[model samples]
Target chain A: HLDLHHYLLLSTESSNIRIYYCFRNIMKELQENFKKLLKTERVPVFLTSSGTGAMEASIVNFFKPEEDVLIVVGGKFGERFFKIAKRFGLNPICYEIEWGDYPKVEKIEKYLKENKNIKGVFIQICETSTGTFYPYKEIGEVCKKYDALLIADGITAVGVYNIEFDRSNIDILITGSQKALMTPPGVSAIIWNEKAHKRLGVNKRYKYYFDLEQEYKNQKEKFQTAYTPSVNLYAALNEALKVINKIGIEKIEKNTSIMSKATLKAFEEINLKPLSKNPAIGVSAICLPDSIDGNKLIKFIRENFNMYIAGGQGHLKGKIFRLCHFGYIDIFDTLNQISAVEFALNNLGYNFDLGKATKKAIEVISQYKGA
Target chain B: HLDLHHYLLLSTESSNIRIYYCFRNIMKELQENFKKLLKTERVPVFLTSSGTGAMEASIVNFFKPEEDVLIVVGGKFGERFFKIAKRFGLNPICYEIEWGDYPKVEKIEKYLKENKNIKGVFIQICETSTGTFYPYKEIGEVCKKYDALLIADGITAVGVYNIEFDRSNIDILITGSQKALMTPPGVSAIIWNEKAHKRLGVNKRYKYYFDLEQEYKNQKEKFQTAYTPSVNLYAALNEALKVINKIGIEKIEKNTSIMSKATLKAFEEINLKPLSKNPAIGVSAICLPDSIDGNKLIKFIRENFNMYIAGGQGHLKGKIFRLCHFGYIDIFDTLNQISAVEFALNNLGYNFDLGKATKKAIEVISQYKGA
Candidate 1:
């Protein structure tokens, strides 16, 4: 389920020490790397979930049922925030954007102005379904204007982007271990600034196991989790974060940017069009030609190379495919995927030059001059 | 903190299948083993929390704040149930028993008879602190008489004891992964009969992440957890349970009884008294002489032999030491620990016959004729 390298896998093996090790001490080392990578001094609490749990955590812990929250929906994850909020008795006002379109800051500010009851705003840094990264900082500022907390689902964004959370008005940032953090699924993190911590103690409705107050008390005071976390993933996260810091987050982000650029350029070299107007740079979403079945193309790639390129979710299903250049994927890996897609499309009778996409991918990769 | 074998460790190393594998399929195999081991047809739902979380889950899901619950407190874990119940606003009517003492079934019946509002009964099958095993089946019968749900914490008891849950009237049985299950500490399982399942959907207060309805929907219907579980621990648990099944729970319990009987005999050889009247076969609590410091004797054994024999908790601290013969520990391992204790007690100037404990242990172990 996760593309984990041996370095991170070896870290998971050291998790036999969970019974003896200080959970906070392990996080302390990893947090330093997180701070260095994200350029933030916020406290991060790790929960045993694959991003969805943490997303649910961010809502149930911080927002009350009596309060209104504004959720900017670009894709599937946005819908998740809206649903979880509704499930817990919160009044969620959804502001839906096109699947591949970025949520506008002015529209959010207008919503906040019109609805003064909004206590918090939820948005994703990267709408994972469409590979569209929103300008969360701009939206964060809008929430700041209304004195509302801005929670960013940075599941596919955190480690791949050079996010300066200290200055970015985002009060909370959520990430999954299986994403850019390079660990397998089952561990998710919620990094919050002082604002989110103030709201943490309130709201007890259906919130025992993921209770932030208990988590804050145990994690901050006793150096442990409120519940038993996937201790192996913490070890894996520490190792992965170390790798990110060693290669430098800037260097990793630079590489991801190169890969993303090359991939989009390569796909465009063929007749396929880029799906997102504001692409995430962590992943590329390309619209498949109606002639070729997206599922068939994905299956061919999976069966041939054992690599997963996701077909779309929701209404976009069978119309587009998401190519992930995120998380430890080098330029050569991107080229191989681009070549695979080209080869598969050609064999399926979709008119395209066989080697042109790979040639264009190399051309885009050669243009990178960053250190 | 846990004594794990290499077999379980190797099992944990195969857990790279979180995103793709059907969570239900994994649990289906495990639930079958659990059914055979516990001799029950009840459903076992695994959560990514240690035993305490499951205890909190028991309180939050089944009983509401208005409902009175009888909690039989003998030691630390029993106190945990009472506290979790109180914290969640459940009226926990505590029936306190002395450390190293069993909870009387007549007293529990007396309490249940008086408290008509009591909706549930909570008790540990074995109190790990004092190594005392309560008559949980008797307690379950009392609950059945009163029509109250019986929740048993079988943390260190389950695989060590041949429990027949189908006939025992235990509505809910909770166990930790690190205990007799032989996995690491990140996962906990809660098995429930039909009676407990009927009440699970009623409670919603402070129960989001550990919400039973959500878990039931996903684990029972969807074949996955409501949230991401520690996939590696589940893999490890499957392997550990397989080993338990192969050896057979009856055989494991037989070995445990033999080990317990031998160790108690060995300790009694040196005038060390076994603490509990109804001692669990899983572990032994021994009262050290007033002249010997429990901490020093424990420290000496730990430093010299790298063996950990825990000093007591609460009033028993410095007065007794608990010896665990639980999990994957074999006869020779029990003998080694007995010999270490004898050696350490002598070094601390406690007058005892050298090697007599080992001799007595050998005599007791030699008498075991069970296959």
Candidate 2:
């Protein structure tokens, strides 16, 4: 279902960086590549906005104001969609789940059965707040059974996980530039199929800026945006797409899985607890002991080794630290970071075996699979 | 009213590019510098979107459905505002002008005088479609007399022209990253003063992603956005701001004016007609001869010299080609491009004297004054 080959490289001046007009044409290629990257046959429209903007656009474009939709609220990102839906006047039915936990397909089906007015279902492939990867494929199947639209947020999941697009039955999939794409922030994409657009036109003229239909056609034929785009970001992403093509997305996903499992093994040795019941391949969120201040541990690692590890947000703040495993990093880098954190935690008054974590990480890395 | 000083540069990794956590903090500096660039003391909030998105945000944030707003429709960019205002359910009273002609100050004054319910007025400082520059200072003064909030779209004018922000009496100013900022496109900024926020509390949560007030506070105090920002775009803009700072803005404006005048003089000698009644310093849009296909002339110059000069968009298409005078390019590059076009036109079954245009350009460049 996924084709990782044939990534097109844009022609630059090669001497200096400048925004070219022909980049508009190259942008078409970007959309196509993103379609392939997302493993969808749908038309993927790129917006000069954040992933959150795409999240908002997906709702307003497909469902009118006051329409009822179902949202899976697991953590920060899932909650964002729920909030956006609510802000736009949609009656969002929240299917609540614990932080670092995923949705039950049967529960979603039960909700759909209970509410026949529900037009669409929204969920995240990986909840960034808790590093939890939901079974989006299962959810998609359930939504299809009820003839409801399934919209998936793959912002942190796309290039890191090779989700079978057709089997997943996702009518719409969203991702951003700064995550697994290895590009900068600002630009995000909404990939949607005929199944979604046929029922509802790509967009109406009401929300003029975020009119996905007009913009999709505009970029396709006009070779220009309805507005000026971030040409520089596209230029950088041109390079990133080439890199992704060379490494091959499946290989990248395989490595991400390997690295995530390795980090989990290392954490077991160092007594760091992974918070997620279904941990994602993109990042690992480890809950620290009540006595150990995660923020101080993070500060120690940054100051000593100049490496950054993110702290948890929302309710989990100061209680967990996240280690990233996707984009511009490899298994060795992960091992090195775990080694740094191990010593840093020790320096921060947390008693942990220093060298044992790295040893366990090596053992996991040696058992790696796939090309 | 306008002060252009103090640009903050961000710290980057010495080896390679990676989205850093501290980048969230550094993005605050990017917003502050944009305020300085726009010469507004008010809070400037950035959106990971294009100028058009900011335009829509400005309209929806301040005005509810059925509110009356004044729009100056002159060219493609101007019509865009009218269209956006119309699409967003605002009653837009258009003060229409011919393409390449600016708005009459008295006409806007009369519209405000008659329409007491007009809450805001929208105008372009330099309409990109026709390369026309309006006298925004005079327009702003007239809007103030009626207590109308003046929203100026300076996407193509802000970095190229030195406008007195406070003296202009403009309440809200919008600009984009691509134009004179010399950064790649995608990100845009909205610089607003207390006058604008006093009547309205910035933005309601309805448009959650573009809730300016919430973003303004989140970026100022929390050092993070409500959503993920295009951190890499901020990184590139950081370097561009440093470059602009070292060169100084007033000098850039003076040089831009000189280049625009020189371009005008060159076109006059080469039989190219200036399209705009009030041509901007940012670009020179030259009307082509009827006998010559302007598109073919542009194609010839591009193919032969590998240089780009943009042809007109919308109604002016195939009738005019634009000569850019802002960002990265110098006077010599302008003369070189002009010379290339002169020969390209002559070769394309047109009659003209050779080297005369470049000679005329040098005469104007020599007369440039101010540091």
Q: Grade the docking of candidate 1.
A: acceptable
Writing each residue's lDDT as its tens digit, candidate 2 over A1-371 gives 11111010111121112245566656867766765665666666778888888898898789876778999999998889998888777889999999998899999999999999999999999998899999888888888899899999999898888865765788888888777877767777787767787755533535777787777788767756666676656655555666677787889998999899999889888788799999998989999989888788877877888777888988998899888888877887898888987887778777766789889999889977522
Candidate 1 residue pairs in clash (backbone atoms < 3 Å): A206-B206, A206-B207, A206-B208, A207-B206, A207-B207, A208-B206, B24-B223
For candidate 1, what's the RMSD?
A: 4.3
TM-score of chain B of each: 0.94, 0.92
lDDT digits (tens) for residues A194-245 of candidate 1? 8888898667655666677777677666768866666656766777777778
TM-scores of all predicted structures = 0.88, 0.91
Distance from true location, Cα of B262 in model 1, Å = 2.5
DockQ of 2: 0.36
In angstroms, the error of model 2 at A307 is 1.4
lDDT of 1 at B350: 85
